[model samples]
Target: MTEAEYIKEAKKGSSAAQKWLFDELSGRMLMVCRRYVRNEQDAEELMLDGFCKFYSSLSGLQYQGSAALFSWVKRIMINECLMFLRKKHTFVIVSEHVAETLALQEDILDNLSAAEIFNLVIQLPAGYRTVFNLYVIEGMNHGEIAALLGISEGTSKSQLSKAKSLLQKMLLQQNIEYGKRKTQQ
Candidate 1:
């Protein structure tokens, strides 16, 4: 079925449609949730919350096209995750120069697996991690991130930079640790 048909059926409150929609979208939405939430359980909860909000808004959705509908819903999910993070008082404020330095370190990330990257993210200080996820992963502009977290744009940029630096440092440390293990073996 076409995406429009699926969305239409879901809007009409069909359980099967809902199930299909959830199944289809949950993976990408969960990644959004995970970006803002540190804990697996909390991420799951936020993912459900995003889906619920998406379903509730479905009736009101004016789809210009399939892409537009999906994009709108994805934005809703991202906003939900951010709001959930906000409720927990997890927003971080940092500087723009720091974000740039971190951005330059992106090349270091190419060697890491997704699991390694996630572990590195978790190791970041709260502020850096939040901004990094918002700016780098979610593609939110500094102004939007600052507005969402109630911080200045400079802070958002800096936090992302710091997050990148920290992630690079952590990965480097991990590489060294692996090298030591191999030498010892």
Candidate 2:
């Protein structure tokens, strides 16, 4: 079915369309939630909350395009992840300041699968991982991340830095050492 048709049915509260949308998007949205949340059950719960909000607000939402719908749902999922973190008092952790810069190997990530990269991200502390996902992956600026996390912009920056450092350390620990291949002369 076309996106417009699906949207029309969903706006009218058709359970079938809603269920179809849920089945289609739930896995990807759950992965998005997992970026900020550590536990699988919590991530699933967060994704469900996002779907609940998405359906409840569908009537009022303007569907621009298929991509827009996905982005809208993703934003909802990210918000749900933040809510879960806030409820657990996880976001309140003081941001760490790591003076050392990270030298992450470029090709190492090239070799790792998306799941591998995601695993590395999930290993970060809650605050760092949230800030990292929001700033780096979600493409939100520090100001936006600060607003979402109720923190100063500096804190968001610090958290991203720490997250990167931690991720780099993790990569090295996993034997993914930093090295840029030198071109042969």
Candidate 3:
């Protein structure tokens, strides 16, 4: 069935349509959850929470277009995932000096694939990871990230800049090691 028909059935509370919708969207949504969360179990839980919210809100869905529906649902999923991460990870700002120094660093994310970037991001400390995800991935400005994380804007900017520098260094090191191994072989 087309997406419109499926949405109609889903909004009407058809279990089969809901099951189909969950099965169809779970894989893609899981990838989004995984970007913010490190553990597979936690990602799975976040994905379920997103789907539950999506299904609960289905009655309010008016299909402007297929893309719009997907985008709307994706935002809901991202918010749910962020909320889940917030519960698991706490953010603590260090000092004004540290935050200032962090902002002076340059970003180094130009050449990395999505998976590689996400892997490096997940390795960051909780504060840095959350700031990076909100600022870089979610496309929020530093002020927005600060408000969401309950820190100063300077701290958000600092954390994001630090996250970028660390990611760049890690990627560079990985490249150098890979090149060395290739030469040795």
Candidate 4:
């Protein structure tokens, strides 16, 4: 069935249409959740909750297209991740943007796999990771991030700078670790 058709059925409470959405979008949504939530189990739980919200709101939700739908779902998953993070973590304000924005060598990035980069990001503190993901990956401006996270734009910039600093540290550690593993092998 077409996506519009599926939405119509899902609005009418058709289980099959709902299942199709779950089966199709869960993997992508799970990855979105996982990027913020460090653990797989929690990410999966968030993805499920996000799906539930989307399913229930289908009747009133406007569809701009598949890309828009994905965007909507992703925002839902991000919110769930943030909710989990807020509960699990004590929000710390790192006033100084001590994490210097370093332009790492392209050669280094070329050597590291995407999974390695993701793992390094996962290693960052919750605040740093969220701001980094929002600013860098999600392409959100500091102003948008401030509004979203309820902080000043300066705080958003500081968090992002700190995140960049931490990511660099993590990347360096990963490089060292990889070198050691390679020697061992």
Highest lDDT model number: 2
Error of 1 at 148 (Å): 1.9
Across 126-182, the per-residue lDDT of candidate 3 in tens digits comes to 677777888777788988877776788887777777776666677778889999999
lDDT per residue for candidate 2 within 25-63, as digits (tens), equals 898998998888989998998898899999999998887
Q: For candidate 1, write residues 1-185 as lDDT tens digits.
A: 87778888988998888898888888877766676677778888888987888888889987688677667767887777778767877665544543557444546667667777777777777778788777776688999988988888878777777777777777778879999999999
Best by TM-score: 2
lDDT of 4 by residue, 1-185 (tens): 79878878888999999988888799888888888987899899988988888887888977679899889889989988888877887355777555456654546645767677677778777788898889877989999988887778888888888777666777777679989999999
Better of 1 and 4 by lDDT: 4
Q: Distance from true position, residue 88, model 3, in Å?
A: 2.8
Each candidate structure's TM-score, on Cα atoms with residue i matched to residue i, is 0.84, 0.87, 0.86, 0.85
Candidates in order have lDDT scores of: 0.76, 0.83, 0.77, 0.81
Worst 10 residues of 4 by lDDT: 97-106
- Give the lowest summed-lDDT range of ten residues in model 2: 176-185
Lowest-sum lDDT 10-residue window in model 1: 95-104
- Tell me the spans in candidate 3 whose CA falls farther than 4 Å from its real position: 100-110
Instruction: lDDT for model 4, please.
Output: 0.81
lDDT of 2: 0.83
Which pairs of residues clash in candidate 2, taking residues 3 or more apart in a chain or in different chains? Answer: none
